[model samples]
Target chain A: MKNVFIFTSMLLISLNSYAAPPTFEILIKDHLFYPDELIIPANTKVKLLVKNQDATPEEFESYELNREKVIPGNTQAIIFIGPLSPGVYPFFGEFFPKTAQGKIIAEEEGK
Target chain B: MLLNSVILVLREVLEAAMVVSLFMAFTTVSQQSRYFLLKAIFLGLVAGGFYAYFLPEISNWLEGIGQEITNTMIHLGIFLLLTGFLWLISSNIVLPNRLVKAVMMGAIILAISRESAEIMLYISGFRSDHFLMQSVLSGSLIGLGIGVSCGIFLYHLMIALKPAAATKFICVLVVIVGGSMMSQATQFLIQADWLTSTEPVWDSSHIISEHSLPGQLLYALMAYEATPTWSQIVVYLTSLALMILVIISARFLQGQPKYD
Candidate 1:
């Protein structure tokens, strides 16, 4: 029974270590984006929090990243991006693309 | 969402309400029968919807007029709107009792025209979302309904209170609000590069993005921009200052004391 319990514990630890999640935060304000560029680990799941500070509505979209979502003014939205390989992903305010534009930099965290 | 929606609705409703109330009041007292007032409202609404539907065509034609001409037209439209609003206030005329039906008709027409302009902007691909179009239309309709009901209630209530003061106050409020809208429209045209060349005065993206709620509200209400190009600043300031001067002159000429 003791041996079996140790094996089970080791398996659980391995799974937890392998499944750790990465996170990122983005801010939307005044028809502009902050931290306009971001980098993250390859094949890793990323939690993106987009906080919209504008009084008008805006849509956060990235064709390369395959992400599109509406972030109403004075609200926040979360999106998952990832398992993406190393590349520079461009994103923008689909509504006011001319004024609201930005990019995301995704890279391998480590070998 | 509700609060923001309500604010939007209220702004639109107030304008509609004013129009309806003016119509009702005028018809009750004017030599023209009540039928004329109803016809005027119907005509105004239909014209507004028609303008909205044809905004794409209208904008194309306007664009063909050249950038300078379009800019001039926008500026002129804003100026006339501001002037009419100011005159209404300074003259201390109760909109319903003293405003001619033709003036009310004109005001409604202008409101509809503004709505149509927005539709034009959207259809031109200047604005991406169709949702905004629906929001504007629904909000305006709702506002109109509310405003009309409120105006009727107030008109009756005023009969018991100081009607003259109420009328004067309402007129001033309308002028102030309408004049502010004109200022915003003027600034937008200038920023869109429709007007004269000017440098970017400064950029504030480093501090806060204008996509946020506060930024948008300021932009919508006052044409506030964090990163205003030089030309945009010039146009904004010039138009604002001119509007103020015009309002003052109008008040003085009409023998109405300035509010400030």
Candidate 2:
């Protein structure tokens, strides 16, 4: 009976973590992406908080993800991405394509 | 992926080319107007380059509504300017050549800048780190060739048609484009939480996927969406009707003779 109680609590803790999808942040400053590479857990829906610190609008575009959103300057936007397979997905700002670039790297859990 | 680059760029270039050709055909391709058109295209390219460079700062301004609002404004501004030009032409009052040329120049600049900006972003995003260089280059070239040819085709076709028929066709096309433009504007406003969204009326993705070639073309030309909300439909139809009414009124006014 005591053992069962301990196992139940352990399972509940693990489940609780999965209940909330991990959040990753990306920032755009001076026409470049900060922390340009982000590693995220694969096969889980994730929330990306993209904050633009510049004074112009930049379109966050990713062909692999087939997602596009416009983030106006000095503001933040939320993007829900992936229950995705493990891989590298590249993205860029349309307004400053040359300077604004980044990637989302997805890997299997606990690897 | 390469196909997408080709298609996307083709769409923008074709649109810019179509507008340029339309204005040229309207003016009977005069030497001076051609020079002005070229200048507009050049200026638009420069503007697009600048837009791309400043996007980092500009995109982040105005409390994150900057991108949506700016885009909405650009499209609306184009619609308004076109409305003025259409009215002037239909009025049949001999407007000054310089004024007409200026309007045409403005139109060309907007058309080119919008398209060129799209192309630049697309090309930059799909940099060679991942895809095969040959495939991307060839696909883009093919798309460019097709788009340029299509523009040429439209110019000749417009030139061959009777002026009245041409006017009607252009008016109809403009109205359709304006409808979609307004629809997009409303969408951005909705995204910014300035407007409410109605329930989606229907989903057409089962019939035609947006990623498909025909779908992409339709999306570019008409702003066709597989899933459309009731609000979008309402806005689209209303704008279309409004544009049509304006054109009809202009034509009716054109037919009235002036007695000195």
Interface RMSD of every predicted model, in angstroms: 15.3, 7.8
Candidate 1 per-residue lDDT over residues B1-260, each given as its tens digit = 22333344444445445545544543343234566556655665676556545433443353222322333454356446545655655554433443544565566555544443332322333244566555545644564456557768755553343444544444443444444455445443442234432333565745655556565444434544564545545555565566567667767777865332
Q: True contacts preserved, each candidate? A: 0.00, 0.02
What's the DockQ of model 2?
Answer: 0.06
Worst 10 residues of 2 chain B by lDDT: B191-200
Judge candidate 1 at residue B122 and give its lDDT.
27
Question: Tens-digit lDDT track for model 2 on B11-83?
Answer: 6777677677777666663323367778988998987877665655665667545665666776776666566
DockQ of prediction 1 = 0.02
Q: Candidate 1: where are CA atoms >4 Å away?
A: A1-111, B1-44, B62-75, B92-101, B116-172, B175-179, B191-193, B197-199, B202-210, B229-260
Highest-scoring model, TM-score: 2
True-structure lDDT of candidate 1: 0.53
lDDT of 1 by residue, A20-44 (tens): 4565888888778988877777656
Question: What are the models' TM-scores?
Answer: 0.44, 0.68
RMSD to the hidden true structure, all candidates? 19.3, 11.2
DockQ for every prediction shown? 0.02, 0.06
